[model samples]
Target: MTGEKVSFGFEDVSEEEKVSRVKGVFRSVASKYDLMNDLMSGGIHRIWKSNTIARLNPQPGELLLDCAGGTGDIARAFVAKAEEVRQRRGGEPAMAIVTDINDDMLLAGLEQRGDDGLIWACADATKLPFPDKCVDVVTISFGIRNVVDIPAALREFRRVLKPGGRFACLEFSHMATKEMQAAYDAYSFNVIPQLGKIVTGDKDSYQYLVESIRRFPKQEKFADMIKEAGFSKVSFTNYTGGVAALHTGWAI
Candidate 1:
């Protein structure tokens, strides 16, 4: 370790070792991640995630990869929708594989969701383990912010997706209006970490949560990055006055 160090979010430490910071965070918060999310977003994350599932339009015999699938919420959501589709259209559900770098979180997800053998893997988003053009759809809800390199992850998502595959990312985004921005910041700073303390007994992890959201790329710039990753028809839909945005693209 060097005497001098660099900043990783609000803390300053380690010039060459700041990047795995997110892994540390998720490790610390893994057990209570879902509970804290419910407390922090007031269950609105469910709505945002539900909307993302809708945009996906998953069909039978398709494969879905839910990256950073912490508690398997997106996988469950996809299965739920697929079941609904099956009721009317009458077919099997799409395969939803939940992958996360943190084993603790992935294990909890596996435990909670109980398996349909819906492939769970330990992997990095920037360097996925799947073969090229193997998945029909890829979704990473609130996962990209923790990635050290956003652009590389975008390219990887595109790579794993089959031709014309769909990619939907649900992430915390810049608020649309000044008033909403101020309110969002206030709530983020004051309320969220406090909930983390009360719920997960971890405040610093939640503080980093707030900071990462602030540091994430803006809406249009991120869409541009997706396009640069060789995706086509990139677009984003801002939800709740841009507090969260769903960016969509198709691998061509």
Candidate 2:
């Protein structure tokens, strides 16, 4: 491992090592990812994602770049919402491009979604493939924490988005109440990994996932980080009493 280190869940490892380990984690869980998500979050992840899409307010003719779109949840919503707008107003439909660092995850998304008119690409979040000002919206849902360098990904989001374009992120967050936090901790540390083992036959991956959520910056801090990355109008809304959060910013 190199001297430059980063967190792979609760463990500290070299930057390269973290990337490889994270890739392995995703690859291991790719097939059962969506199912495990439903189990672990009790289907609240869907609600959180729906809240994110609503806040994004997808419109006709807009191009949405969904980075680390794993299993294509966000991209699917974006494309569908844009299509709804198009059918209602009689204009060209909006587009969504789903990019993921893990090929297995991308393949899973492809297989699950089939050809829904959403473009799929295997790409890294920190170094997005799109040209400058190429998209009207950029979103990374429940995936940014897995990035090796979140700031780099945020910068890439800014680069790809047109001025006035929006960036939205939905991810696990610290709970609002101490009582709720305690309960969440118990569930996270005890139940989620077991659920992962039962459902995906991979407990360690789920353990790492829970730990990664803890390692991620809290809601307000993440909003500031987005602003530091050159996003304006940065704001966040907590969901499910802060069990998850939706952070939004404008490229401006």
Candidate 3:
């Protein structure tokens, strides 16, 4: 894939360029990313993430590898939920490894909540640094579409999971109906970038984010991609009139 071109928010660019630009975009918005999410979705992203964690059913003593875990939202939640279960069931402690390709995002996460005892690392999704079958759960939230090689990343997610381990992803997806699609498109293409400019002073990054969501595959198609990447019993749950979705599979 050295010379291949990939979609960088509706524009065709070389893989290296896409990686560089995506890192830059995240770096630009790292400090304000969570705030932008709340503004863009009216706090609905929090619900979506909560639902995702519930469905994941994190267990005590399980290790979760949260890829592209930008601000460690999912990681913190997973560890907390698992700890809750451990307290009730009398089990070992649970842990999470929050990894991102961009250091600025990781630094932002550390600055916000570094005392949670969660491990932090810099890692590429397509080529993870962990050993095979190392983690019980793998998750990526709102970050897969920015990957230069999505299929490779999926395989890596599967690769790092132990047998019978779970994989979950939360991402922006197509709206359920044409009417809703029209309304959502008008709002997304018109308002989101301006909100980004107001909040983060970076309109282009948010524009690319919206475009990347549009470029992502539909729910069923992504489930099939997960199946093709050696996962089984793949499924997805649409959230908020399909404005976002949670996809899940098991490494078997």
Candidate 4:
């Protein structure tokens, strides 16, 4: 332990501890992750993900590296969209590699919906296993907040992308209006943990998750961070009045 404090939810913990706790949280919730996501967002998360995939505009023969890709949701969707393009035109099959630090999360993805054109690996977001400038697209959905060194991870995302390649992130973000923020806080603090307990038998994990979202940087600030990570043409679009946001940039 370098005695470096990192946010594990609202609580401060050592970087190593944060990593271990995050891994444990995912491992505990791995089996019920998708169900919890649907329940938490009232199935709107699907629409958000669909919007992300559409914005990414996955092309045939492109490679997508989905860091912190739990249960392969984004990976599967990316491959499917790319395949649609390939089938319509003529191109090589696109590949999506789903990587998460938690082994159980990877296992859950493989067990739940293993599909062709998708590869699963255990990887840390801050230190990806692949060579630099190797992938066409890099995406992390609803997962970057949990990373202890977000800037480092962002740099890694840029590092793995080929020049002109795109990077997109979908994350829970700050709401636009004070009224909306108030209402969202009420529901998030009051309701989400209970739902977690009912569904996954882990209220604490959900509590941490909620806090993590609040701790995450707001839209404009995060976009700046992406730019600072050596990406250009960075921008962000808020979804559902900023309940979530999609941030995009180019490696160049």
Candidate 5:
């Protein structure tokens, strides 16, 4: 059943349908996504994201390839952190190359953030446009689960990294406590889409957001997938009691 195709949402779907559905969700929720992230997580996403940058151990003169990096939140965070380190050490600044699979998201980022050393490209995660061993670090946040092929994307992350390059993926993960699951489930199933409808006028797309998290590979299994992709020193750190997890691996 490993290769058996499944659709997004609760419906049974062919692989093609899943792709189409996910695309629609991003397009529909593009404008409201950043806001929804704040609302749904009660601003904890900022903490989760901040923690991700902290783990990157950002360094100067390093090149960061940000995958599925919509709106450049990770890019902004990286730039800020990298700049702070440079200021402290009086060294060169790190560079951030923002990459995303969606044009609307990329364009929104460019229009909102402007060109301040942030590079934007419309590229798929499974087919990254970079040379082998090219980037010093690769990071994907909240966007990997939206990918059509997780394993292929993982392999691609490995392929585009320099020797000893770092990879960090921050994603929604299964909840840790059984007591919390029901509350989370009820919030996801009943409250989330309704909140979306009230706020963004789009309920179905938010519904997809809830379901995709459930469909994602659990934490340990995902670490195994990263290892299988030829990444050494693969490990994960759970956050907010497993509401989200950050997986880090090195290409060695």
Candidate 6:
């Protein structure tokens, strides 16, 4: 992966360069990252996340590793659900670790939510810092596309999960209908950058985001990639006309 070139927005960049470039993009937008998500998705991002949590069906005492869990949204959701189950059953809450490659994003998350009993760490998705079979579930929400080596990251996710553990990912995906796709393309390419500039005062970062979403593999292809990474029972559920999707598999 050293000499090979990967994508940075619409441009092709060396693997090392792409990593730094993506980190820069997140750093630039870190201050307003959550706000940008709200604006970009018209608050539908929350719904998508809630649906992910529903599908995840988090259990008490299950450890969850949320890779690239920017601002700890997914981690928080998992923890909250775990706590709910614990309260009903009179047990302890599950553990959650929120990991991201960018310190700025992690720091921003700390500022907003103050840890919430979560372990916040700056760790790369492609090479996690966990031992084998350490966690019961691994999740990445709206973050996998930024990974320079997605297959490596998927393998890492599989490595960290215990047998029968689950891996779930929620990300921007291909729209299901042609008309919706056309409208979404026009909006993403046209309106998102303008919103970013107006809100975050950064247009290029949002442009890169749109391009990266386009570069991510479609749903079926991504599921295949997960299967190739040694996961079983791989499946995906598209939300909001496939604007976002949740892919789940078990480390069987």
RMSD of each: 2.7, 1.3, 0.7, 0.9, 2.1, 0.8
Q: Is candidate 1 or candidate 5 better by lDDT?
A: 5
How would you encode candidate 5's per-residue C-alpha lDDT over 1-252 as one tens digit per residue?
A: 245577576666766667677777787777777888999999998999998899898888888999988889898788888888899897888898998878777877777777678878889898898889888999999998887788899999999999999999999998888887777888888999999999889998888889888888899999999999999999999888788999999999
TM-score for each of the candidates: 0.92, 0.97, 0.99, 0.98, 0.95, 0.98
> Could you tell me which residue pairs clash in candidate 1?
none
Report lDDT per candidate. Answer: 0.85, 0.90, 0.94, 0.94, 0.87, 0.94
Residue 234's C-alpha lDDT in candidate 1? Answer: 94
Q: Report the C-alpha displacement of residue 84, candidate 3, in angstroms.
A: 0.9
Ranking by lDDT: 3, 6, 4, 2, 5, 1
Find the number of clashing residue pairs for candidate 2. Answer: 0
* Superposition error at 34 for model 6 (Å): 0.6
Tell me the spans in candidate 5 whose CA falls farther than 4 Å from its real position: 1-4
Q: Give the range where candidate 5 is weakest over 10 consecutive residues by summed lDDT.
A: 1-10
Candidate 2 lDDT, 1-252, residue by residue in tens? 346878888999888988899999999999999998898888988988988899999999999999988888888888888789888897788888989999999899889878588888989898887899999999998899898988889999999999899999888889998999899989999999999999899999999999998888888899999999999999999998988899999988
**Per-residue alpha-carbon lDDT of candidate 3 for residues 1-252, written as tens digits (9 for 90 to 100):** 587989998999999999999999999999998999999999999999999999999889999999999999999999999989999997988999999999999999999777489899999999899999999999999999999999999999999999999999999999999999999999999999999999999999999999998899999899999999999989999999999999999998
Tens digit per residue, CA lDDT, model 4, 1-252? 357899999999999999999999999999999999999999999999999999999889999999999899998899889899999997998999999999999889888886555888999999899999999999999999999899999999999999899999999999999999999999999999999999999999999999999999989999999999999999999999999999999987
lDDT of 6: 0.94
lDDT of 4 at 88: 96
244 in model 6: Cα distance from truth in Å?
Answer: 0.7
In the predicted model 6, the residue pairs found to clash are none
lDDT of candidate 1 over 132-248, digit per residue (tens): 999999999888887666788899999999999999999999988999999999999999988888878888889998987887889999999999999998999999999899999
State the displacement of the C-alpha of residue 238, model 4, in Å, after optimal TM-score superposition: 0.5
After superposition, the stretches of candidate 1 with alpha carbons farther than 4 Å from their true spots are 1-7, 10-16
Quote the lDDT for 169 in model 5. 97
